[model samples]
Target: MTEMENKAVGYTVQQGVATITMQSAPVNALSRAVRVGLIDGIESALSDDSVSAIVITSSLALFSGGADISEFSGGDLSPNLPEVLDKIENATKPVVAVLPGPAFGGGLEVALACHHRITFAGNQVGLPEVNLGILPGAGGTQRLPRLADPATALTMIVTGKPTSVVKLPGVFDKISDKPEHLLEDTKQYLASLNAENCIKRTSDITLTMSEEVQGVFDAVTAQTKKAARGFFAPLKCIEAVKGAYTLAFEDGLKHEGKLFMECMNTPQARAQQHFFFAERAAGHVSDFDKSTPERSIEKVAVIGAGTMGGGIAMNFANAGIPVTMLELKQEALDKGLALIRKNYENSAKKGKLTQEQVETRMALLSGTTTYDDLADVDLVIEAVFEKMEVKKTVFTTLDKVCKPGAILASNTSTLDVNEIAACTSRPQDVIGLHFFSPANVMKLLEVVKAEDTSADVIKTCMKLAKRIKKVAVLVGVCFGFVGNRMIEPYGREANRLLLEGASPEQVDRVLTQFGMPMGPFTMGDMAGLDIGYYVRQSRQAFISHDPTYGAVADRLVEKDRNGLKTGRGAYLYEAGSRVPIPDPEVLEIAKQEAARLGVTQRDDISDEEILVRCLYTLINEGACILEEGIAAKSSDIDVIYVYGYGFPVYRGGPMQYADEVGLGEIVDKLSTYAERLGDYGKMWLQPSDLLIKLAQERSSFAKFKN
Candidate 1:
């Protein structure tokens, strides 16, 4: 005698089907009440003779965001999500899960319990529990391999990366184009899958390996070693997948569950999860009223047609917005426009975009050498050279030509947004929209708020960044704002370290080992050392007194070895490719520079020292940035690094990495480094007092909210 009771879960039995919906708002996070309701819902559906089949879905934008993250941090797991999902898997009635948005974490586990999964187009699904100091305890590790190949399951679970619905491969039974008609569509598909059999458990299925499975595993391992590096979850994910091949059904489930629990207690998982929420938290700012009106940004204009402007224009154009790109000369405009077409063409070649879609988007872009085209734009982003006078001139011209109520923005990486705003008649409308290099691809957008900038203007800029598929971090105005401000010292330390003992290759290798995509020398080579040389020249007076600050970078620029563009820099490149070779000349130069700087050249620089010098310095500066209010929160700084600077996702970001290293230990190391090296060396080495204070109280950056 199964009974139906309405609670956190909503259930309806109609026309031989029972639709069980997780009725939690925001993100249907699997809570205790929801788990209990789900278990009861499955039982009721299974006992009802009228309900021949059952369908499960979420009543939110997301199917399920996994388990409530807060539950694992000392909060009870509530009858436990795994226990509830087990009941669903054992249900006699055939169960189907229809996913509209993302089925993440336990959400994916719930779907895995059902015999079949039907997802809508654009849906994202993954077992991302590895990020939260836990693995998918709800049978995800055991069931994923039964549904997909071991290698595919390994990649999805271990990496904790999302799989797009368009490229889901073997994860789901079917993916429909129209999600609004998902139930009907799924029912029609289910009619085809109908048999005498009832719901079957994924654990009972035997996974067959392909002939190239070993080769596949080998390739995946090699890439994971390079990409994940110090991260443990990815390797553990591989182990879980291998379990499917070596162990029996029950044994595999036990092995998977054990590994999943081991991942839950790892420091890496905690850090990654902290970063996950930090990224979402980056959007919130104090005094930024929710009621602030967002300007309608449809037709947009970019003042410069160079690389930055071209990329910025592409972001707007890619979002289906009509963008007018302006350049001073026809030749410059043509060159920029050609690059835009080439970018689209490259994307089409990579199958990232369809040819017709590329052409359609490219057709939406227009170019001009005059300000008349700017009149119709709701927003204008000035990407001219980062000079105050040039920016002021552009703003002055824009003020006269742009229509009223239009938002004016500067894509300045470090320059003062307030100074740029000062040139305009409507200073309140001026805001900073700092996009990382390769704007169309990079996710970070530092939304700098000037003292006089209107709330609506800032809100509109943040909203616009999202519309263009960029992660916008609301920041207070500063010289370099959040990302680049902290980056200055971090980059400075890398250069200083080279002059002290480390070579270009050694420095980059050390930082790369610490999980940075590239070291300072490699980055310098990529960005062209001349830019840093020029920036140093701009700040010569401030840095000149300290020979350790700009000397090595100045020497690199003086050698006329700019970067990859010149086939030489800190490291030499083998023509046409970006791969760096350890140049003997650069090593000799580093030795000479160390001698010249009166710094000890030691061959015994431990990997630990190298990691601490590079990462801790970056984290210390992040703390300073937080204190100065340049960044709204520690999470904002984390987002700046994770997205903008290629900080490793699994280690979270610099701030989360600091928490993992134990902030007290970081303070001790910084104090030791400061004592050995002078203040110049200690500039970045000094521990953030905020970090020290937090450490003393046994707190974490994750605990500190804005």
Candidate 2:
């Protein structure tokens, strides 16, 4: 046997077979080194007299996750992915690809380029380039449709989601009978192939547009438009796929490359890609790493049995871990359990879960009515009321009942985590796992680090976040942590805009056009107007200084208009519908609130002014957050806002959007607003010092070394 080694991949000949193994550990990112090695390895195998067949597989690593995204930040390198893939597809000898795990995006493109592809039952493959706001540049959109059903291929490309090897029939030449025997299956598959049959290329396959396929294209295009709405990449992906059917293979490849470049240069692409890295970066803690040991949280307990608590308990059950739901009474416990069952059954009805799978997950959850039931739990998170005293009582009980080293978490969105930690004897074990409402679904989890929280606790919770499929953004303890704190100024401005001049519909229209899922007024109405009224009462200073704050919302609730529940709030809802219709009555109420609060109502508020005030105030608060070190890095704040607050994903959260809008522009706009509003603007809307510095220097939060 002869061996040839490179930095990222190796070439070796054993018997009549040449094996090219990728050496990048973990997810073998298709970096420049790997591309060079792949081209070199294939050429070496072709030249060697002893080598009759070739197999490309990773060396003790999961299959490639696609392009090395970090490399994207730099200039072009030699032998790009397309060049490497073309070398593989055009190889002389029979080439086989053995996928060990997921082959996503460009990685799947590489496998598609091989003459014969083989994988295990559980292995997945996809061209998910649409996620990064780009279509597949290296022939993925072109070649995938050549082998698979065009609609299926188009669906996979448009959605940017991985599919099981078995689910995609024509794509893989051979599949392992057992999930663990992919290598054996590939060897047998290679043994069956000779040069006469093994040298087939995806480019030679012809694709034709049929009536059904055209229908699929139309349906998917419409669906993508509706679902992704303002997104730029998904529609581009469909266009690239359509090229595969209309144009020749080489032409399709060229078109795909053009589309890829077009999407890559888009601001939406930059924003989505920034969020991709930001979400991953949020998991890393600067002070502690692998050396900081994490405690096990196998068994969990969630106190309270309401919507938040029940949803919190479901996350553990879904992960196949035992969870105890402890309410003060049996009735509450049973009601919570029923809601959890209903949620799972609904998923089962939707085919998202099998009946057996639903039962299996439900079996992992149990309900109890005593604090003593939580003693044996590894972690206990209180999902009770948001008041400080109520959280203290829960922590005090948890401290007395929970085992030593057990984590005590509070699901308090606006209260101090440190004060709750102070009520416990084990302050080091206390942290905040603040799951957003409908906890089983929302991705953002603010891991609030209290004053006395230990590194181990942080590490454990961070690790646990991965298990539960949540993006854990570590934040210092403060009022409302990151998401709520930032939203305060944003919501404040939107509401104040209502009283000053802008109608509810006008403010909402401006924000939605700026790419928020919904404006603050719509969100407040859906969340219930009374909720804001009570929150305003709690923060007397938060509202007292600014008389216009919460005035419309307070008056709406006083009229028994509590939003969707009451059929009226900021906007009136027709019976049995959630579509908020702009009511003249609501505008009249706003005018009255403005008069009562002694705020001057002006008709000159432009849509641009509304957009700037709402988003810029949010950005200003984000800057203050960065300056205070409450958020570890600026990107973390971006991730929290995008995932937690429905701040536009394509705009890359508040800070990234600000950087794109020009920091200097923001400083000028904010300064102008402060001067225009006098004392109120100076007190509330002044640009943070960090924003002034970054803007003057023409720097971006995305360019930060952290």
Candidate 3:
């Protein structure tokens, strides 16, 4: 049969099934074309005697990611997704949906309209509209409850956890061999079943609720409260699912639509959606096209078999790439190898990896004390102690030993990539691949490009990052690059706030409430206070000579309060657990430091002030980075923080959150704080010119993107 194209839809009939693929590109977003196509496809399927069943799917990665995001903001407006789902619900003939991949939001609603649904093993299903700042508008709240229990459906919809095919409830007919083969399996399953006995529209099924359901609902609500904090969509999603149990199917859908629309209009949703596209846009480099071929890297080499070096080697080996690790002595190499083996054993015990797979990865790794082993490697990453002289010496050696065209990279977090490149003959090959702590687990790689670094080298490193399951952000060379540079101000503000009388626990509580994983002090303990102390000492020239500069940190180091390690840090720690205990000594030190600096302190710090001081400091620095062209865009900064740091995903990234908070408000607050403390506060609270410009124009930090 010929493919029919409606302005709002695309239709193709094959065999006995009429397959309707949503053709909206990029995200395959459901708009007017999708709604009209859905209606027309159903009509065509019902009219044709040859078409026994209709299978709805998408021509993209998602069946339908969600409703058209643009439509929520009133661009190319059409009869919304719920009305489109209504057409599907009222169809006469049985509709079988073949969900290939993610069927979320209106996508899941489209599946619920069908009589039978089948998906592949890797397919992930959800009513994740809530994540985008909306509820599932098209029959999701109503239909999902009928398919799964009200509580399970609510958790899936509210939390936005993708429904894994292996763990899906018995509602879906079968799991197909491949995503593309879903339609065939669905059609065969439909033909095999008696039409009268087959399950029809989700709206026709009665929802079941029990005491277990009530308990699940209660438990999930509590968890969501703790997890989501003050987010509206997750809580509102719970209310919509509750409607499914209390009201009729259509009535429940009405409630869902109302809640969905409310979330769509919220500032939080707008910020989150901005982040959604920004992350996807981060890898785009206008100067580098797809023609720059990535070098074939089947093997990797690591110099220095310390903690980071071992982790870096394991990351390569885990990705099935052979890795050769070099250490100065045989004993050091043996210890590193032993640690790698222990790590694999622990992973296998935890059921994270099988014993055989762990052994397989271990077999791929080879360690040596000599640099000669790195001679034939395609890529070599240096992870020695953070000193420029040591780095230069190592690269200078590698330059002589390693073959030509080999990509040499560094795993330095906060160093000048250009200085490191100067040690190597091929500066274009030398790039900074700053892996977060415990390199094997962390998902971020800061790919720093020095001034003379080649586009091909950047491209290869990005591809390599993806191959190792890491999100790579191409950045320019700077003192701390993206993550740590912005983090400096954030940490500084947190410390200054403590000097002004807020206790460690109080500061942690406020930041945790604001949706960070932990406050600065708690994180300091976990990371070891000595590292920061060393960095502080190293950068003494950059810091103010005032008494507050390193007084408290130096005192903490002196007292053996090096955090978690010494059983004390910002707060006291028990023997085993990380649960923070309040310490009098530290409190006394903070008070003394406040007095010594001649800074007036407040006993009670409001949550609002604490949040603004800590967060705005980071935002202010991000604006400066944008103005300096250190970061190409505000979104790039967000990506760096979201992946590298523990920034909350639901709140978007820091920059997006700042945008939602209003640039003008932040600038005014900075000026207010600056006016209060005069010179002392001026250094920390100095508002960036970008922030002032954005505030004056009533623009957002996100608009600074290239």
Candidate 4:
């Protein structure tokens, strides 16, 4: 027996079989070193007469995360993934790939290249390159369809979601029932394969072209166009798969490579990849050390049993943490509990949760009308109204009732966490867990770090957010923290655009076309215009200087047009329908409001101007947030917008979008808009000094420090 080793890979030969082990810890990324080692190990196995069969497996927990995305941004390295995989496929002896766990992206591509594949039944595999704005570049698109039916192959590649290897027919030659016996299973399967049972290369499998197959391609093309709007990779993924039916094996591989590069070269891909790293980066606390401790949260309590409070409690319940939902009255408690049950029941209906699972989560949630019931709770989150005084009152009571060392959290979106912490005796234990609307559904949780909040509490909440499955972003205490602070200017500009002559639909169309899930006005109407109307009222001192800041919205709310609740808002909703229909009365209201404010309502507004005015201002405010240290990094802001607000994922977050549009270009546009609108634009859309400095230095937000 002989053994060989490399930095990220290992090779050993025994019993006439050679094994290649990927040992890169924390998801074996197919990096340059790994690639080099694979080529070396395979070449040695092929030349050695002692070895008849080669097996590729990982020494790590999983097969691999994917291709090293960090490598994608840099220059090409020797022995790229395609060349390595090709070497494995062209080997004279049978090469078997074993997966103990999941294989995604290039990892699955590597396995597909092997002559035979074996995995545990529980293991999953996918070609999720489309998620990073690229199709499978390493012969995946061509090979997957050759092995699996084209429809199954198309769905897996296009959606970029993992599937069980057993579900993908012909992809895995053997599926082991139990994971503990993976080694034994692999050995048995290898022994069973005779010369007659030797499998052909995946690329050698022919896919017959037919009208029905073409229909599957056409239907997926239409579906991908609708589902993956403004995205470059999904459609390219479909095109690459289509080549499998039209082109031969070698030609299809070349076609796949062409489409992969085309998608990789797009700004959309750059943005998606940036977000992929940014979301992971959002969890790290820059100043925290390895020694930083995190507290355990066992029992939980939530104040207020309304929609927000109920949703907040559901998160803990879903995480298997017992929660006591406290309300001022029993009736409110019963109502909140019922609503929570209804939510669980609805999810059970969708098969997202089983009937037993729904009951289990519901049983974890208990309701009470007394603060005394929260005395033993490990953490208490105040999910009451947005008003500061209301939050203060809740915290003051929590400071008295909760056990010492218990973490107290506020579910406030925009109010100051610092001031809320001041209400409690143990300010260090008080942090803001600002969950978005429909808290159970929304992925973003702004972990607001107050000035007096201790590091342990911050770390503790961040870890807890992960337990509940959230994209937690640590942000400093401020008026609106990270997400909402930047959105103020966004909503302000969108409103001001109405006065300057852009209709509701026109502004919405421009923004939605630019990749936002919805424009500000439509979002405002859906969230209830009265909510913003009240938020404005509470912050009147902040916006008192500008009379026309939200005059149109204020007037609408004053006219009893709260939103869909009243079947009227910026646009009147037809009875029982949430669709926004243009109302002449709303336009008349805009005209009157504009005239009253002494502002001109000109129709010269173009879609480009509207896009710049709304997005660029939002970007400028993000720069301000970065400078203030409200957000530790630009990526944190992007994480908030992408997850909390429906800022388009393809566009990345606002900061990533700005970098793609060019920071210098953004600065220039802000200046131009300031000159065009004079005082109004200068007041609202002024670029921050940090933004100016980065632009002048020809730098991007991604590269900017401080």
Candidate 5:
């Protein structure tokens, strides 16, 4: 027996079979070193007379996680992935790939190049490059369609979700029943194959499209266009997959490469890639390392059985943790439990959950009207009314009933967390777990760290957020934390646009065209117009300086137009539908308000002006957030907005979008607006000091270290 081993690849020969095992730990990413080793191993096996067959597998459980993303910015390296795949495909000896775990992207491309493929029953494989704003660059787009049906291949490519090997009948020659015996099973299977079954390469397969196939392609393309919206990669993926039927193997590969490069060069690709790295970066807290101890959170309790409370309890119950919900009365408790049951029933009807799973999750939840039932709970989150006095009463009661080691949290979005903590004797155990509305669905969980919040409590909630499948961004105590704080300016500007003579539909149209899921007025209507009106009333002293602040929403609430619940708001909505219809009376109110406020109204308010005023104001607030160190980095703010507020992911959140638009140009435009509109614009549109400084230095918010 002869054995050769390098850092990334290991080769050994026994009898007539040669085995190549990728040795990179963890996911075994296809870096430059692995590519070089693969090329060498294939060449050595082909030249050796004693070796009649060769097998390629991995030392770790996973075959590979595609290419090393870190090397993408390093430009073309020697022994690139394409060259490595070509060498494997051109080998004269029979080649087989044995997958033990997931084979994704370039790893799956390499498997397609082999003469035969084998996998275990539970192993997964896919080409997920479209998620990164690029299609498979190393022959994945061309070769996968040859091995699988074009429709299935297109679906896999566009969705970027993995498929189990058991479901794919023809994709693998053999699937091992026992994953632990994969290597031994592959060797026996390779030896059993003679010349008739051994020499089938995916590249030699021909694709013939019938009329039905062409119709499927057309239908899928139209569906993708509608779902992808303004994104570019998914359509390019379809174009590349179509080349397999229309062109030869080499020409199809060339076509895929051209499309891949075109996608890579686009701004959307850069934004998506930035977001991918930014999300991972947001999880890291500089002050707390991995060694920091976290408190055990086995059982949790939610105070108040309102909408937010029920949603928060569902999150814990879904994570397999028992949850107790407390309400003031049994009627309220029963109603909240009914709403939770209805939500799960709806999901079961939609096939998102099985009846068994819904029953199991519901079994984990319990309700009580007494605060004494929360004595042994590990954590208690107060989702009571938004009023300071109401929140204080709940915390003061929780402090008296809860055990000494139990954690106390509040779900208040805009109130002072520190003041809430002051109600409890143990301020160190008090932290804010400001979950977004409909907490079980929304991904963002703003972990509010008060002035005296202990490090261990912060670490525990941050880890708990991950357990419940939410992205936790650590934010300092402030009025609205990161997302809602920045939104103050954005909402202000949307209201101001109405006073300046733009129709609600016109403003909404421009924002939706710019890639927002819905315009500000539409969002307010869905969230209820009175929510903001109540918040403004609570902060009357702070907002009293500007009489026009939230004027439109206040008027709507005064007219008893409470939104979808009341069937009227900024825009009219038919009963049982959330679609916004423009109302003449709303516009009339805007004109009357403008006349009373002594504001000048213009007939032609350009979309560009509307877009700049709203978005730039949001970015300026983000800059101030960074300057105050409320957020550790700009990417954390991006994480909150993208996951919480329906900010488009393709734009890479507001801060990353600011970097793309050039900070210098933004500062210049804010100056123009500030000078154009006098005091009101100066108060709202002035650039932050950090923003102006970065603009003068020719830098970006993305580069801001803190």
Candidate 6:
């Protein structure tokens, strides 16, 4: 027996079989050292007379996550991934890969290059580089189609989702029942293969461009174009897959390389990459490090049984935690539970959940009408009405009912969390978990840290957000918090545009074309016009300074146009449909309001002006959010907008989009708009101090440190 161990790769030869194991822990990314180790191990195994076969596997659980993303900016590292894969493919000795877990991106490419692949039952594999806004650059696009059917391969690549090895029967030569016996099973399978069954190279396999192949490409292209609108990489992935059938193996690799570089150079790719990093950065809390202790959150209770409260309860139940949903009356509790079950049933009908799984999730939920029932729960989140007095009443009750050290949280989007905490004797226990509408589905959870919120509570909620599959961004206590706070100006500008003679459809079209999920007016229509009307009415003292603020929406509510529920709002909706149709009546109302307010209407408001006025105002508010330390970083605000508010991912939220637009240019545009619009614009368009300083210094929001 012979054994060799190095930093990145370990080599051993036993019983005529040489084994190469990647030693990098926690997703063995192919770094420079790992690449050199792979090359040397292959060379050594090939040269050794006693070694008849080479078995490659990972010392850790996963084969690899992909290339070292940190090295992406380093440019041209030695022994690039393609070269390392080529060395494996060209080797004369039988090369076998045993996958115990997921083989993603370049790792899947490496498995394809090997003569045979053996996997454990639960092992998964995929080429998910398209999610990062680039096609696979290391022969994955070419080789995957050769191993799997073209349609299957295209689905995996374009969606960037992993599939289990068991579902893909022929992809691997052998599947082990137990991961512990994977190596032994792999060795036995290798021993069974003679010269005739060994050394099957993927490159030599030819793929015919059948009618079905064309159908697959056409369908996927149409779907990707519609689903991933304003995004560039999904379409590029489809093109690279087509090259596998049309071009020879080597030519396909070269074509894929060209397409990869094309995707890498796009602004969308840079934006998506920034978004990926920003998501990871958002989880970090400056005051709470990894060493910070977290309170246990095994049992959870959610106050209120309305949409928001029921949705919050479902989040915990989905995570397999038992939940007690609290409401004022038994009828309300029964209705909420019924809605939860109906939601799960709908999911089952849509194939998102199995009938059995639906029952299992529902079985985790229970309802209560008394606060005493929540006394033992580790965490209690109040998702009652948005009013401060109502929030104070709930927190005050929770302070008396909940056990010491139990977390008390509010789901208030705009109310001050500090004031809510003040009502509780244990202020440190009171925090804000501002989940977006439909808490079970939306990804963002604004973790609002009130003035006296404990570090332990902050640490626990951040970790709990991950457990519930939500992206928790730590934020300071303020009216509207991070996302809603910034959106105030965005919605204000949309309203102002209406008063200035831009139709709701025109305003919606410009912003949607600019890549927002929906225009502000359409979003208001869907969310119910009265929701914002009531919020504005509650803040009348602060907003009374500006008469025109939210006037268009107020006019809609004054006319009893509630939104989609009423079938008439900013835009009209037909019965049983959510589609927004431009209403002449709404336009007439806007004109009447404008005439009453004595505001001049312009017929020539270009799409550019509409896009700039709305997005720039949103960006300006984000800068103020950052300057006040309400958000730890500009990226946190970006995360909140992207995940919570339906901001475009390809644009990387408003702050990143602002940086791309150039802070200096944004400042100049704000100055121009402020001067152009007079009093209303001056109140809304005045750039924050941080924005002015960054623009003057030619810096970006990305460079602003909290």
Task: List runs of model 1 lying over 4 Å from the truth.
Answer: 1-7, 47-52, 58-63, 98-102, 116-125, 130-134, 149-152, 158-195, 207-219, 587-608, 679-684, 688-692, 695-706
Model 6, 118: alpha-carbon shift in Å?
Answer: 0.9
The CA lDDT of each predicted structure is 0.81, 0.87, 0.82, 0.89, 0.90, 0.89
1-706 per-residue lDDT for model 5 (tens digits): 6777678999988888888889898788998889988988988888889998999999888999999988889865788898998899888888999888899999999898988899988889998888888999999988888878777889988878899888776788899987977778886897798977677878888887779879879988999989999788999999999889889999999999999999999878887888888888878996577788889999999998889999999999899999999998999999999999999999999999999989999999999989999999999999988899999999999999999879899998988999999988999999999999888899889999999988889999999999999989999988999999999988889999898889889989999998989999998888999999999998889889999888877999999998888999989988788888999998899989999988888997889888889889999999999999999999988889888998888888899999999999999998898888899987789989999999999999888886
TM-score of 5: 0.97
What TM-score should be assigned to candidate 2?
Answer: 0.96
Model 6 C-alpha RMSD to native? 1.4
Q: Name model 4 segments beyond 4 Å from true.
A: none
Model 5, position 25: C-alpha lDDT score: 80
lDDT of 2 at 356: 100
- Model 4 global lDDT (CA atoms, 0 to 1): 0.89
Looking at model 4, the pairs that clash are none
Summarize candidate 4's per-residue lDDT along 1-706 as a digit string, tens digits: 8888696999999998999999998889999988998999999999999998999999887998889989987866788899999999998889999998899999999999999988888888998888898899999998899889878999999999999888975888888888888999888988887887565688878888899998888898899899888888898888889899889989998999899889989998988999999999998887566799878889999998899999989999999999999988899999999999999999999999999999899999998888898899988988887888888888888888888999999998888888988877899999999999898899999999888989889888888999999989999878888888888988998889887777888999999998888888889889999999889989988999999998988999999988888898888888989888988888888999999999999989998899888888889989998998889889989999999998888888999989898899999999899888888877887788999999999998888666
Candidate 5: pairs in clash? none
| Cα error, candidate 3, residue 377 (Å) | 1.4
TM-score of 1: 0.91
Lowest lDDT sum, 10 consecutive residues, model 1, at: 1-10
Q: For residues 444-543, write the lDDT of model 3, one tens digit per residue.
A: 8898999888888888888888789888888887889989998888887778787888888888888887778888899999999898888988897888
Clashing pairs in 6: none
Error at 143, model 1, angstroms: 2.4
The clash count of every prediction, one per candidate, is 3, 0, 3, 0, 0, 0
Candidate 6 runs further than 4 Å off: 178-181
Candidate 5 lowest-lDDT run of ten: 282-291
